[model samples]
Target: MSPAEQAGTQPELTYEQARDELLTVVQRLESGGVPLDESLRLWERGEELAAACQRWLDGARARVEAARRARTPDEAD
Candidate 1:
């Protein structure tokens, strides 16, 4: 299944939603109680979530840069 489908019963999440869940994943990993396999799984998920967050941030940055460029010509006058 796609990442949007989630691995199991979990629902699809937006960038912000994935980020929130990633914080939980980080907290669990830091607490150090889960099994090895589970820890690895969380780590993998965290990587994906981090990538997703980066994509969102990159897209936002691109939009802002475009907006600035669009305004630059006007500002020059």
Candidate 2:
């Protein structure tokens, strides 16, 4: 079994890694040389990577918002 499977969680990908891989997937799909089956698989993987990137961005945004709310009015100036 994979380490993540053993750990009972999927491996965590950094936002940059997911975004870079999503770019590669997009490039491959755009290049138009892959077979239909491979293209479909790549498209699915792209979706997964995009979701991961979005989750990372959303978490970061939430943290920033929380920090802003926590700051005193004087600190905001």
**Winner by lDDT:** 2
RMSD (Å) of each candidate, 1 decimal: 5.5, 5.7
Enumerate clash totals for all models, in the order shown. 0, 0
lDDT of 2 by residue, 1-77 (tens): 33234436578577888899999999999999899999999999998888778777777898899898877476646
Candidate 2 clashing pairs, residues 3+ apart or interchain: none
Give the alpha-carbon lDDT of every model. 0.80, 0.82
> Once superposed on the true structure, which residue ranges of model 1 sit more than 4 Å away at CA?
1-12, 74-77
How far residue 43's Cα lies from its native spot in candidate 2, in Å, is: 0.3
